[model samples]
Target chain A: MNFFRKQSLSRWLIHLWFIIFSVFCLIPLVYVISISFSTESDLAVDGYRLIPKTFTTFAYKYLLKSPDQLITGYTVSVTVTVLGTVLSLLITAMLAYVLSRKDFRGANKLSFFIFFTLLFNGGLVPWYILIKKYLFIGDSIFALILPYVIMPWHVLLMKGFLSEIPLALIESAKIDGAKEWRIFWQIVLPIAKPAMATVGLFIAFVYWNDWWLAMLYIDNEKLIPLQYMLYRIMNNIQYLSSSIRPGTVNIDISQFPNETARMAIAVMAAGPILVVFPFFQKYFVKGLTVGAVKE
Target chain B: MSYQTKIHNSQPLANMNVKKKNTFWREFLRHKGLLALAAPGLLFVLIFNYAPMLGLVLAFKDFNFRKGIWGSDWVGLDNFKFFFTSDAAWQVTRNTIFLNFIFILLTNVVAIAFALMLFELSRRAVKLFQTTLFFPYFLSWVVVSYVTYALLNPQMGVINQLLTQFGFHEVNWYMEAKYWPVILSLAYLWKNVGYSTLIFYTGLMSIDKSLYEAASIDGASKWQQVRSISIPLLSPLITLITLLQVGKIFYSDFGMFYFLTADSGALYATTDVIDTYVFRALRVSGDTSMATAIGLYQSLVGFVLVVTVNYIVRRFNKDNAIF
Candidate 1:
């Protein structure tokens, strides 16, 4: 009876700890969301709050009033993410499928060729110059899409998934005179749907969340993605805040809805992924766990 | 008679050469479809990955805008000397290694602990906790910076408001270099720990329940079962993740360091890392040659570390070795 009590106590303790930590994880996001919904005057007076004293859509309304930049950012981000994800998935799956075939000559060598990139690269300079100078891809959509298209890590993850299908499955198809491409399309792809979703979501996230490529290659305002847009807005805010004198009492930062609007932009930029990911959480967990353990 | 013998010997030798060539060609014809499937990706990799590798030679060249990579004047060791002699070199290098070491150590310990705790829960409870815990991981560092700003904003930030309420002096979180190491680590954990916790939880789930039952039957406590069965089994994974992180200690997550600090020049003392430093040198300072040199240094050291660590891992567990 004492042992049972002790075990239950510990279990309850775990529950309590997780609840607290989970709250800790969520507080920042909750605070930001709350501030985004609150009016600028309330924010200035109350600072940031987990719950707003008064709720208004003033910030979001302000953002929507001049939604040209926001619209362009959304359109570009969505276009690149969708295009990049599909193309990356196809390319990665094909390469991985080839390497997954034990019967294929040079499979091991080719696998090593892909894996070596994960270990080392020429670093940022050559890569930047190659795309910018040699390829002339700067300020283009391809600049964003091309660089991340054949991520070595994703290729390997897909390879790990693909190699698990039985060789006899492919052999029987080959016996029926199905070509390698046909076998890959007809037999392999349908079975690899879960892995595809997992890897595709990951690739999509990379394309969507990325600002690094844009920062380096993009100088055109029209080409900026959502994250980079958010980055710019935040950058300006930081500059504004830092440039002000510490002792100035008369300057009201909130007179312009910039503070609340920045948070709203952030919320909008990050909102879609947060909303979409929960539905795919199971596959996300499976992919990450399997990838970690298997690798 | 000699002429006839020479002709006879040469005839079979010529046939043998043709046969050897035919075998290779036949094999190529057979695998042509597979090669076709791989070609697009192979081409991309060659351009994006391999081309830059060849372009590492730019590290030794004085980059002239009008002159291309091939036509640039060779200035052997000068770019490297520029990087090594700079004061930023030691600072960034030390910060990268030290901070990554702390992050790996702190986050993994916390993750493992959390994973163990969750291992004690029921399925429904685990699901609920996981949903909330993993929420932060989806936010980009750019967004997280906004969240960070809301807290650390000098005047009207929440922490400052709270500090004044408690009769303590408000902290200027952004300007203070001393606070960033802790702040960054906490931010790192907030965004990352859940992913790793779930990983460790998955690892823990794979452990045989029969062992725990058998231990309990022998009067072992839950703690004993964990220490004896769980930790020992989980060590392989923990070691693998740690060693993998150690391999990339030279590279910081540029997004985190860049966005969270908002590239503040004030906090560069503690927060500047090799990656951010390289970016600033290349873009902000327009010192392409020096940046390339630093990049080369990072890549070579990173490669050696990864290869060495992989070798060490392979010595014990072949499957665990990344290569």
Candidate 2:
């Protein structure tokens, strides 16, 4: 819409600005992926080279020496992401559907009740104590799943989507003698597919990127998630060398995947998520567009 | 709703209006299935969210587990006093507010500028740039910490190597506290700019295209159009976003600060915020009480800030107020 001449100085300057910033934004990923493939000797010799001087699989090989931790971490993360996304989507959609109903007398009250949670909160220690002591879900997988399942912001966004579906459709379905459950499953759910895909990706990403819950709640080695494991290793390399899983033989510090292996592990931890990014790119933008629309 | 039963029965409105008193009850029974479906989620929020607002009382107590939450001795204002009186109090408060202020201002300007820039590009170029820019937002901070380490590592980091090539001595980025403020701000901008860019872009897209055409016909230059139309129209949404940001002034992005710094105590002077401080109090010092106290302080101030800003917005422009 900036209808300046094709060869204008501002056009070239803006293009240069965006091109530079895009590269700057990508450098973290480029550097990490590059170092992950670099030979340990080359990394030590060159010190964070942009492209690997001598590419090798040695870092990944050494990092996988104790395959149990990596496998368990992935297993925990994938399992939780799958289960958590489904549960969160169902609960959020149902609650939003109810709020979307113009006929439901409690809709306004319920909306305010849910939205109020976003403003005020019980401080972390109390919430922590609630889950850890009162609920007794401590060290269990439920600790990770329960806290995030009812995100109010997602509920509000889903309501916006549902509200856009013509009210007459729901009324017509009900007048045809369909049950509420049938109407929701057959009529509403299919119409709201785009919204579901967007929120599903959002919830899945939340479950994937979480390390805080695992750090706070679980002490069990079997339950450690990928991000927390990456965090421990990256925070201190010595932890990687020692028995990350107790009851296993302790490795000497010198043989640890001390440098290259650490970066390699970071790459592996983020591997599946990054590969899935392009697939969900459209849906993610749609979700943000939903927010912009509501505004 | 059962209030519409007369319509289904093909009866007159006079007949149904007499029985309107029972409408709510009958409607409740009629929609029992939907109500049942919504119960679990309602219960979940009740237990997790609203229930904890009561636990803010732990901020006043000694937090003895044996005594339990209700049974603990009341030590009113002691914890709050301790938080404000602590030596690290002012520094942490300043860091939290200052960092958040800078992020709010910087992300808005950069995101809006980038959004305007995206508007000037071809469709293919916009898509390509959008993906690359959004990539970092998906990465976990733990991975990013290693990325930061690669760039800032004392001996073999890319920055040091670049310095050496320029005929200057290498600078140790981690040990120094001064460099972290700039680095952390840059990191925050990198992770968030893509999301904000999308928002601003959507806002720009929603504007009627014919307006720009009409402006050009009237001999309005590009800058004039942007200043008169784009900035004026977008300012309300921008202010709303800025107010939402101001609400979180007392909070910090824990992962960004904790992970990217690699938990180097040397840099804590410039980097630590209230959230990290509370986390350290909980983990390292094993003082849950102190942690809860600081949390209550942060939440109270934040809650007040959000409500007050929202009230001000509502008074002026009812359409833009969040609540």
Candidate 3:
């Protein structure tokens, strides 16, 4: 009877600990969300209160006022993310399929070629110079998409996933006089949908979150992606004024809602993905489990 | 007459065979669309990843803008010489190694604890805990900086508010260098422990359940079962993650160090690592050659460390080594 009581006591303690930890993880996000909705003056005075005394969407309204630039940045971010993810998934799947095939003569060599990039990289300066001088992808949308298209890690994930597909499926399709492309498109891709979604979501996340390429190769105002724009806004308050001029009057830098604007930008950048997260959550977890084991 | 002529014209038949071989070449040419699919990615890597590798020679040269990279004056070993002689070099290198060591050690320990706790929980509770914990990993450092600001801001921060309410003096966290190492490590663990916990948890799940049952039946305590069965089985994963981190120990997470500190001069002593140091030196001074020297230094050290660690791991357990 005493042992049963101790077990129940321990179980309660564990449950309490889990709840506390979960709250710890969530409070910062709650603070950000709350502060975003709070009046700027209220946040400045109160310092990120859990419950805002006065709630207002003034910060978001101020942001949405300059709808043109925000819309353009959004469109740019979405286009690159969508186009980059699709191209990357198709190419990665095809390459992975070829590499996963047992009869492919050069599969091992190709796999090694892809794998070697993960180990050694020619550090930042040279990479910067190459993008600027040789590729000349500077100040273009291609600057974002081209440099990050084929991540070796994702390719390896696809290869691992493709290896799990039944060989009989491929054999039967080949026996029906189906070419390699048709067999891959018709049979393999449908079976690999979960893996594709997993890898695609990751690739999309990378493209969406990318500001490194813009930081390095892009300097033009029009070419800046959403994250980079957000970064610029956070780093330089002057950018907010210059980019989002309401009229001929120069807006006071002090009056430009800095703190709440930062939170609002954070929401705009990550909020869409977070909303879509639950649907892809299962596949993501599975992918992470497999990928983390190997890495 | 035609039939007899056809039988006699064996040379024409040989030409026809050669023509068939030529048609094979033509077929390959006609399928250029297949190869075109790979073109954009191939071109990108070649230009961005591979071509930059050739510019590594700048580390060996006295880089001059007028002469360009290839035309730069050859000053072999001087770039390396300047780097080795500098006092900041050792400080940055030491800071990088020490910080990474603490991160890897603490992150793994905390993650393992969380993973064990998580595994012991009910299925529904585990999912809830995971989603909550893992949410931070997706947030950018820029956003995390804001969160940190909210916690540690001098005047209106939650901590300060609580301290004042408790009759304690409010501390200026941003101005203090001594408090930053601990603060940064805690922040690092908070953001990353979820990832490591998930990794360790998945590894735990794959462990055969019978091992635990057998140990329990043999009068082993929960602790003993964990020690005897769990740790030993999870060693490979633990080693792999540790060694992989060890490889990049020379490179700090640039975003964390830069953004979290908010480029405060007061915190540079504790916060500056090789990457941040290089960024400051290059951006402030515009010394292209010196930046290249630092880059080369980091890459060389990182490469050597990875190789050495892999060798050590392979010595103990062949299957577990990264290579």
Candidate 4:
């Protein structure tokens, strides 16, 4: 509480305690990275040592050598994430723009209709049956991207963000005879870039992190997203080693870097995002905090 | 309140009906473009959110897939009865609620403590700690499951290796049920606590700093300020978050339970929850109706629990109410 006065031991202790936690935080990731780069024998023998006794990309080599599944997984994940984020943002921003407008008739009810989904839902089976039977999107690429492309909560957050833009901007544009979509694209979208970026990042993350849909709808290898593919690979390791599904990969257990392969699969699945995660962290924190407060 | 009055109030003019009709048509016509723009999203929510809600009716049907949902023989409450009559009703319910109870409590304490510690730091220090802490928040649960496996793998796990070094026997973490409650919780905390901590930190920052400054002026110790000013102000946010989580207590994080254990049936005693239970049950029977029945029960119970909790919070503390 005192800026000028020093609280010697307590200050030192506080810093010490947090630094310890930071280390605790780093261990899992570091351990993961360490094992990912370790050779199979080293991983199996030394058993999750912080530093690998022998370092090799033996598993990565095998992973890359026969790369159909990995390529399929990556392509599906990237396509889904890109398309889902862009389309979702456009839809969310447009809807939020309409909802933010003070003069839109029944805006309150419409917003409530969207918001109601946040509090209640049809649950998994009904939703699954709807998509499977009616929407006819089960086991398709759209299946991976559609379910989460627009969320009601994100719409409300965008409305909150968009509402803060001065109404005169829209009013003046309307007086100039700009169409609804034009005004939304040119005037509203530019001003709401920060909010768009925030929402865009959120949407991208959801698409990237999602495996639930992949689990539910996808049975085809080509259609599988990376996360679920990694999920299959992990389980396949369990199954293959148990001889439940023989010769699925055509590699014996001891031959490939099996232990490191699972870890490596995880690393590769998350690797791209981790590379750029730091640049986006500050905005993510801000966006999530504001969203939480608003909720 | 005022809208209700306007709707019910009678007009004196004979032309009032014509005027009202004109206004309704005029307003509707004026908003046509806006409605057109909103139509797609409205449709999306209608199909995705509203249409599925209609499927809750499946709980009362026998669900013959070849015969279609409507053609399925109606079995009023039979599906629900079948679910509730089993041992699964108790087991999954207990596991779901128990895990959520532990998660809500532990995650809250850690987040708050971290938030408080974060508040005491310099701005640069805060950013550094936040970046490190939140790194894991970005990783998917599948990735996290491997990290858990790496640390808990009986023969190759870091923890087991450490135990062996110290002359303790290895822990067969996958086979063991007793340890998963803690293991799963710790895995969850490591992955999720960062984001929630940041949420609490933001709440902490919003506290009228004047309260703290004034308390310090009155020669209040740091602990006193935290106890009186910080904790009390944060209570509303705390309750809001807790109740939000409580609303979903019937639903467990499928990724957490499923992947962390690698679907090890050996550990289901401590780890299984409603989502997993339903999933496993569906796998065995391919019974869409049964799954829907369980889902409806879960959703209804959670909806009621949250509504009741929210109502009580609103009654006592109007400012903290979620709605």
Candidate 5:
């Protein structure tokens, strides 16, 4: 009984530690959500709160008043994510299938070709220049999609996954007179579905969360994705707040519900991922574990 | 038995035929279908990856819009000279490696400790904790920036509000460079520690439970069991992750450094890293040549570090090496 009590006490202490850490992880997000729902006037008066002093959806209302940018952002983000994920998965899976084939004469050379990208690169400047000047991808939607389409790491991860499929299965398909493309499309892809889902979700997350490509290549407002839209809104707010010194010309920054609206925009932007994450968490964990354990 | 014999005979006969008539062209013709399937990806890397690699010659050239990458005259190391002599070079490099080192050390320790705690929990509790902790990983840095802003925003921020409630002066968090190393480290941990902890926990779960059972039977305490069994078994993962991070010491999460700081010039004292510096030089300052040279320097050094680390890892445990 005494030993049980001691063990339980240690377990409770561990539980307590995790609860506190979990709260620490979650509070900032909750605070942001709380502040977003708070009235701007209340925010200014009460500072900020874990729960709002007075709840209002005024920030969201304000955002809806000019919905064009938000709509465009959603469209671009959705388009890039869907188009990019499917195309990326297709190329990545196809390449990985070829690489996984033991009889493919060029598999070693091709694997090295893909793997070397992990080691060295031309760095950002040359890549940016090539994309911007040489490729003429400026302000185009392809600018957003193409740069991330063939992430070498994802390729390698998919290769690792595909390599585990029994070679006999593929060989039997070949003996049945299926062409390589037909075999890959029918046999390899079906076997690799779980991996595709994992890699696909990862690629989707990359496209959905990307602002880097937009920041570099996008000058067109229509081409800006949701994350970059949030970024711009945040930037404008920061500019307003910083520019308003004690002695400045006193632009009425208060007219723009900057504080609450920024949060509202963030909640709207990240809302979908949060909703879908629970369902997808298992696959993500499986993917990460497979990658890590292979080492 | 007959099926196995037929497969064996056919495989050797196929190999013999290939060995008898194999030329590069014939092999190419034979695998054309597979090669056809590989074409799109091959073309993509050749264009997007290899082309840029060849374009690293921009590091040596004085870039002019009228004169394309190959058309430009070679400045012959002037770009590199200018970069090496700059005050920003040493500062950014030091900050990059130093901050990365600190982040890696702090995050891994916290994650390992957390993973051990999670390993001791009931399944339901572990699931609950993981779900909550992993929530932050789904958020982008831009959203995370807002979260940080909510806490650290000068006037109406949560921290400032709490400070005032505690009878203290409100901190101007953005302007203060001194606090950023700790602040950035915390932000990094908040966004990332969950993922690392998950990785470690996955590793811990894979550890044979029988070892712990045996250790307990041998009169070991829980702490002893953990120290002797859990950590020793987990060291390979710890080493692999730490070594991989060391290989990336030259890089920084540009989003975190850029967005979280809101690109405040004052905070660059502690926060400027090679990636951020290279970005600013390319976009903010329009010093393309210098940026290219610095980027090339970073790539070369980073490549060497990764190769050396991977080689060492391979020497110790060939299976665990990234290559």
Candidate 6:
């Protein structure tokens, strides 16, 4: 009876610790969300409050008033994400299916060809020159999507998932006079939906979060994605205050909500993706399981 | 020969002949739809990945704006000499390797602990906790930088505000090089603990439940069961993660260093790493050749590191080696 009581006490303590740790992970995010809605004056006075002492959307309002740049950034990010995901999924699935086949000649060679790139690469300068010279992808949307598509890791994951599908299905389809194309498209793709969603979400996230390619190949202000634009805005603000004079006389540097604006841009940039993440978490878990366990 | 025997033999031989006549091109054309499916991905890798590989020659050339990459004059080892001779080389390399070593050790320890704790929770609670914990992984470094600034900013920052409120002097965190190694590690842990936890959790889940059941029957305490059963089963995964990290020890997380430090020169002593050092040398100083040289050095070292590590791992356990 005493031992039973002690066990229950330990269980309660474990629960308490779990709750505390969860709060630790979540509170900072909650703080950012609340501050995004707080008035600038209240923020300055209160420092960072858990709850908004005085609520206002002025930071968002300022951003919305000059919404052209923000909207363009959003459009570029969205287009790149969508196109990149679809293209990446298609390629990953096809190559995965081909490589998964038992009798496919050169499958091992092709796999190695894909895998070698993950370990060794030419590094940044050469890669930058390649994109600029051979691909001619500078200052374009392709600059964002082209570099990220078909990661070797994702291909390996997709291949592992495809390998799990029974070989009998392919053999039976072939016996029925079904072409390899028809067999793959009709049979293989349908079964690989979970893997596709997982790989697609990952590819989409990479494209959405990317600023590296933009930093390297993209210099035109109009072509900037949201993250890169936010990066530039931060740098631009610093430049304006220290280096360049604003072209207009009426604009006062002191009135600008630099701190609040930085937070607001962060909220705008990350908000939609965070909203979509939970829905995709299931697929992500499945995808990660295959990749992590196999590798 | 008997008629039935001859007919059976000829039928099997005819099938083999048909299979042999199916050439590579014919089989490839037969799978044209699959080829079409592969086209976009192949094109993407071709344009982005493979094309970049061809540009590696630029490291040996003086990049003249008028002459371009191929048209430029060959500079031989001058670029490499500039890189090796510079003071930045040793500092950046040391910083990269040292910081990465600390991160690998610390992150693995915490992640393993978190995973163990997670296994103790009930199913419903585990789901809730995981979602919350994994939230930070989705955020970019830029956003994470803001979170850091909110805490560390000199004037109205929360840390400073709290310090002054406690009757302590507020330190200028941005100007101090000493605080960054700790701060950067904390930031890295906060952003990544969830990912490592998830990986470790998956490893835990894969362990056969029967082993734990048998251990309990053998009069084992929870701690004993974990120590004997769980830790042993998790060793391979732990090794795998560590080995992969070791391969990239020469490279730094550029976003973490660049954004969190806010590119302040004051923090360069403790924080400047190979990637950031090269960025400063190339973009800021307009020394493209030196940057290329440093980049080449990093790549070569990273490649050799991975190969050496993989070889060592293969010696211990062939199955776990990445190759």
For candidate 5, lDDT tens digit of each residue in B138-224?
Answer: 789999999999999776789998999999998888888999999999999888888889878877887889999999999999899
**Number of the top candidate by TM-score?**
1
Q: What is the TM-score of chain B in candidate 1?
A: 0.86
B1-323: candidate 4 lDDT, tens digit per residue: 35433644654465577667666667767877777777777778888898898998998998877877778899999988888998878988898999889998999899999999889888778888888888788788888888887788666788998998999998777778999899888888888898889878978876888998899999998889989999988888788778878888888889889999998878888888989988876666687788889989988988899899999999998878777
Local distance difference test, each candidate:
0.86, 0.81, 0.76, 0.81, 0.85, 0.77
Task: Please state every model's RMSD to the true fold in angstroms.
Answer: 4.2, 5.6, 7.7, 4.3, 5.1, 5.7
Model 3, range B1-323, lDDT digits (tens) per residue? 45534744766765676666655655545534333433554555566566777888988888776677798998888887887798878878878888888999999999988888777777777777887777777666766777787688676667788898899998878678888889889889888988789878877887899999988889887778888998888888888778778878888888789778876667877888988887776567777777788888888878788889999889989878876
Q: Would you list the rank order by DockQ, best first?
A: 1, 5, 4, 2, 6, 3
Q: What DockQ, on C-alphas, does every prediction get?
A: 0.66, 0.51, 0.30, 0.56, 0.57, 0.42
Lowest-sum lDDT 10-residue window in model 6 chain B:
B15-24
For B58-141, candidate 2 gives per-residue lDDT tens digits of: 888888888888999899888888888987899899888988989988988999989888877776777778888877787888
Candidate 3 is scored at a TM of: 0.85
DockQ, structure candidate 1: 0.66
lDDT of 5 by residue, A6-90 (tens): 9999999999988888888888999999988998888777777999998898889998999999999999999999999999999
Between candidates 2 and 6, the one scoring higher on DockQ is: 2
Residue pairs with backbone overlap in model 5:
none
Alpha-carbon interface RMSD for all candidates, in angstroms: 2.2, 2.3, 4.0, 2.5, 2.3, 2.7
Compare the candidates by DockQ and give the number of the best one. 1
Ten-residue region with minimum lDDT total, candidate 4 chain A: A286-295
What does candidate 6 score on TM?
0.88
Candidate 2 accuracy as TM-score = 0.89
